[model samples]
Target: MKNQEGHDNSMNTLNRTTVSLLTCVVLFASFAYAQGEYGANDFRIKVDARGQVASFHDAVHRRERLVPTQPAPLVAVKKGDKTEEPSRAEFEKEPPLIRLHYEDCGVSLDIAVQETESHVSFEIIRAEPSDKVDAVIWGTVSCDHQQDGG
Candidate 1:
């Protein structure tokens, strides 16, 4: 009986390990495929499945734009308990009115990025309603650079 019990425990452990490994592999694959890029004339943006503007480039301006200061979107949940934002995401679709999903609090954040020749828009739609929903934009800051007078 003792030997049988030991075998059962070992099997349980093995099963858990296998499940965890598979989950990691699946998550990695989803994020890998979820990333996308789009361009409307001179303006272009790269988006990750985790609902972040990974990078933005303006070719006509001759310089890149927007550094990612936050690892992911700022969010606050139930009782102000912050949920761990997903670092990667599963892509919903491709360019020009692209959609991305971020899983949190038993709900999915359906983020949409729409673009036109000269305009861009973003919206976050909740798949399931919950009181624990708070998302904030990571904005941009400008600084004036100067040098010592000659």
Candidate 2:
């Protein structure tokens, strides 16, 4: 009876260990699929195309998502003529840039994005220099989250 009890205890321990390991793997995979990844070396980033920057990860940090809530780089395009904003053209689309032509006002903002190993950058180039300034577009990013990717 003593030997049987010892064997049962060992089995219980193994079962608990297996369950715990499985739970961890499932959780990690879930975290991974929650975002789409893009990177330039260590400057890896994730964006979900929800008018937000989804995550940013690096070597110094575990494989955790740095941005989990709120839209990132809130971009707003305004036209002096009160023209409606263009519908949903992603910053992550096939090419990471947008060109807005305001023929009504004779101006445009040629916006470009440059992502690097340590930085995600954007550039707004005027199609031509003009005080006519038909529209303005901008963004803001804020996150200080710490979650172990492991």
Candidate 3:
């Protein structure tokens, strides 16, 4: 009886420990995904949790082009008249991709990020529920001019 009771207590302790570890992992993952930065050469871009461009910087030029507080998204799906942007975004480093999720529209957009010596490019590789999508809006960016009086 004594051994059985001890074993049961040990099992309960183990279960509690497991649950605590799993909770920590989830919290850490969320914190990590809160923001992401991608860069190459003289350019860098930081994306917020909602997948909006938080910062577009040119190191050589010393300029930040995107308005971090702007409500406009870098990409939006126009379904009929409503423009739906991603409610959440996760960044993946391997092959470089930003996975955007639109919960209301029940769709996902995968934007591929490609960087070169001179520039960075973003291309939408996949858009789910293509039929429901009317148009893709790029951006209404509030930015500083890259150059003066050109």
Model 3, position 63, has a per-residue lDDT of 79
How do the residues 1-150 of candidate 3 rate in per-residue lDDT, one tens digit apiece?
A: 226556667677789999999999976565466766878888787888897888878787777877667675768788987988879888776667787888888888888888887877889998887777888888665776657342
Local accuracy by lDDT, each model = 0.53, 0.53, 0.79
What lDDT score is found at residue 109 in candidate 1? 49
Worst ten-residue run, lDDT, model 1?
Answer: 139-148
Task: Pick the winner on lDDT between candidates 2 and 3.
Answer: 3
Clashes of each: 0, 3, 0
For model 3, what is the error of residue 11's alpha carbon versus the real structure, in angstroms, after optimal superposition? 15
Ranked by TM-score, the better of candidates 2 and 3 is: 3
- In model 3, the Cα lDDT at residue 54 comes to 87
Count of backbone collisions within predicted model 2: 3
Candidate 2 Cα misplacement greater than 4 A, ranges: 1-38, 78-87, 91-110, 126-137, 145-150
Locate the minimum summed-lDDT window of 10 residues in model 2: 83-92
TM-scores, all candidates, are: 0.51, 0.41, 0.71
Q: Compared with the true structure, what per-residue lDDT tens digits does model 2 show for residues 1-150?
A: 225556667677789999999999976544333334556665566555343455666646645445556455434445565643323323324346544445445555555667676666757754544566555555445556555565
Q: Which order, best to worst by TM-score?
A: 3, 1, 2
What would the TM-score be for candidate 2 when compared with the true structure? 0.41
Name the best candidate (by lDDT): 3
